[model samples]
Target chain A: MNIYLRLVYRNLRANLDRASLFFELIFPLFFIFVQGFGLNGIVPPFEIGNGRVISYSLFLAAGAVTLTVINGGTNAGTQLWFDRKNGMFEQILMGPFTRAQYILSIIFATLIIGVAGSLLVFLFAFPVLGASFNPSLSGVLTIAAALFLGTVFFGAFAIALSVALKSSETFQIVSTFAFFIFLFTSSVFFPATSAPSAIQVASLANPLTYTTDIFRAGLFDAMTPTVSLELGILALEAVVMFAIAVIVFHRIRV
Target chain B: MGVNQLSRLYGDKPAVDRVSFDVERSEVFGFLGPNGAGKTTTIKMLTTLLQPTSGGANVLGFDLKTEGRKIRERIGVVQQQDSFDQGLNVETSLDIYGLIWNVPRTERKTRIEEVIARFGMEEFRKMPTVDLSAGQRRRVQVAREFIHDMDLLFLDEPTVGLDPIVRRALLDYLKERVHKGLTIFFTTHILEEAEYLCDRIAVINQGRIVQIDTPENLKRRFGSARAVEFKLLQGSSEALASALSSSADVTRLVQDSGTGAYRVTTTRPESVIPEIYRLAERHAVTVSSIYIAETTLEDAFIHMVTDDENGRETERGLG
Candidate 1:
């Protein structure tokens, strides 16, 4: 109920109705639809010895929520830079809230929007992927937590960029660059097991890869490692990224 | 907290030099300066947007360097440029601002309507900001400052491009807010806005405050003071010049009417007037019409700022 918290709340709420708002919310869903159902006819990544034609669509759905989290950071951070360029940043700076509050507000708002998109992905995953894989309620909860962590981590990434990039053009370039780094390199759209030996090691090192692997493990019984250890790794990455973001935010001029 | 000589610099030159000012309980302080005069720079420091290079200030007694959050909580700011989300309607914009402070649902609706009415944006409540006119959008931007109560408000060029009617309304609203016990700091290029609205003003040029005073006091300080114009029945330049030449306080004298009258410019009018009377009577010149004129703020501003002693200086060469 304090002004700082209230300010954060108001900022996020306004973001909900923006054009970027719908795009941030729906972009992940699009990724899910294309990767899930639309990609059924693609021939690559096909290991046919098992006598089964697999649908990667369901597998893609499992990663939707986590992808949205990363997008949240990039989109929100880019928008912040745009606002600053337009002089709107000065208006917020003149208000009675700390920079930390401003950053936290964006992160929290993105989390909500991220979750909404992810929940839709979760429901879609169940029907297309052929029901529960016995990961249990705890496993399901574990995946949700991982997705949330990934979302927060990326959201922080965006805030950091927004604070650092003074110009809207610079922000766009950085966000675009960061998104590519997040995609292809991560295990979101590809199986970590089969990626190039070099990329496999990098994927393991990537936070998004861990998030996708953690969620994929919950959806498919084929995952080798237990969900607990994967959850630990995701949480650690989230904490480190989040702390760095806060420090970066505190260092900003406004 | 009072702003204590807060300033900024770009590499070598100071964007704002050691500038100091204090706001008490409910005063409306106007910062009058031309473009790039450190008006925005000073406000940025006060609002904790930019850190000071040499001197620092406080807000509501909170140290700007260390306690920015405390300051941010107790003040409202309207920047020089409009920054509202173009995607949102007027009604939604207020709701979002209110939500930022976490106002309760019941109070938010009423507050939104009240602010809309106060800012005269009721008709545009459901209209997207992108669709509104420049003046309407500006009204929304200013209206954002009123979503909730705050101890102080900072307005940076709040009425730019606004017509006289809307500008007056905005000024009146600001006055009302100050009357309700809110300390308001506003910046303007328009001298009339400062003259009519500001309780006290600080005029800055090239990142430094050249003068700070009431408009009247500034006029007196820089203006030509008493202006004596006389219609001589049969006066001569030699007689008037000789009579007024002995006065040390007179700035200048012009005897160009050719009708035997003089327009005397002086600070010591009391002495000059008597000299003029005696000179006229001694010369037997009949005095027709004589009147003394006072100085104005515009004249004072032109004298001190525009002139820079001669009205053209390095700082204003191209501007």
Candidate 2:
């Protein structure tokens, strides 16, 4: 087996514990099941701007998937921090791996976990929201692209954060604050179109907003020129964040 | 393996100065040094973990700077830090390490069982590494390195937390491996271990090589003086101390305040022992016990380091 693949396997196997399973799978499932179902009665249906309408439950389902991918990215970056603390970072570097190979393995592992978690969320949400679901080939492609680019962006962002921070407590505090900012400012729960002007501006600047918008457009077969533009910007953000991550990670001492 | 003027600098200060050495195939070369004497720094550079500021090394036929991957693929390093997958059990951690080295499945399993039994880790094989004691964790960290094949192994203070039996077992295991054509570059603060296991020992101090020779040669070179000690039975040894100090063969003499035993450091113990008996009889003090103590590696190491420090200080004073 290739060294990168072996490292990816090691990462996946090492993280298959109960806490990781609950946070990566069960936590997001709660939002889809409890939050989505509870909010279905109070929140009205959304006019998704393409002559298509989506229930609040379906919108929350997309947000739940986005949350899973975000957690996966954070997990990917924090794994590096924990490995450094436990001395495995130097240990692996002393083995048959270069720095670039090690970082790439983590990024690739994040991608796998992100995609898998998103699919698992969709699978579990299908029974609850299957009545209003409509599928198309182009729609599925858009969702796949959104998930891929979103995972890359957030994974690189969190990795850069992890490498830049000196202590685990600071990383935890900052990442939690950053996650809340990303979650609330974006169109994950409520549409940015209906939100206040200041929030709308913040939502427009958030990558999560683009990810959630692209996901919603795909889920409701409401792809628009704006969604395409968001996809392009998300790709650019992913590229820049990944470059920063590589540069910062390369400078880390053994 | 050969190192030529290998040096690593932390900012303006050098952690490992321009020190050079070589290890022949199947040789257990011991690197003995005090704390912060650049042993770990040298090992890091040799193992390709840290880049040298200035200098070069060729390890296992690969250039240290250009072919680090090749060197890493062929060599194993047991670092001083404790490293293991905290969430994994002992068996899983060892198995995963073997997989990382690309060991074959059958061989990995065989080696895992062999090392577990050899290291007495069977009782905790299924326990998580996070819950193990420090000694148990260190044992696993060292044992996991043996699951793969390598030409040379670098062990940095691997026996720091092990018991006497386990420490001896690890030393014997390294000896057996060296006998089968595996070269080992070992570093430890324990001089006795170096004396017993190292074919040739290098004493590094203040980032420089002070001395390098076989264990026997080192002891002989820096530890030529023998200690002659005699305890008086009845009378005071005040008369005997004056007589022993006047002898030409005796270089230094000290009388114990509590035990009333007089110790004499001399070049010739045969001549000094007879003189001590004659002097004790002359003083009406009967000799109760007497013995000539041989020099040890620890004694030689202390003498060498202290002499090196004093020499440097004198040079500074002259400058």
| TM-score, every prediction | 0.79, 0.88
Residues B1-319, model 2: lDDT tens digits: 9899998899898888899998999999999888999999999999888999989999999999999999999888898998988769999999998998899899999999999999999999999999999999999999999999999999999998999999999999899989998999999988899988999998898888999999999989988666788887874566778877999888778777888777777768889999988988788889999998777787678767767887889999999
| Stretches > 4 Å off in candidate 2 | A131-134, B225-292
Model 2 chain B lDDT-worst window of ten: B231-240
lDDT of 2 by residue, A1-254 (tens): 88888898887776445577567788778887888899999988868868888788888888888887788788777778878888898999999899888888888889988889888888878676774667699999999999998998888888899988999788878987998899989988889888899999999878899888898889888878889899999989889989999999888877
> What DockQ score does model 1 reach against the true complex?
0.36
* Chain A TM-scores, candidates in order: 0.80, 0.94
Model 1: how far residue B54 lies from native, Å:
2.5
Kindly list the per-residue Cα lDDT of model 1 for residues B212-244, writing each as its tens digit.
787778876787655777777665657667767
Q: Candidate 2: lDDT of B105?
A: 91
**Residue ranges of candidate 1 with Cα displaced over 4 Å:** A2-8, A17-57, A221-229, A251-254, B103-107, B225-294, B306-319
DockQ (Cα-based) for each candidate: 0.36, 0.57
After best superposition, candidate 2 residue B33: deviation in angstroms? 0.8
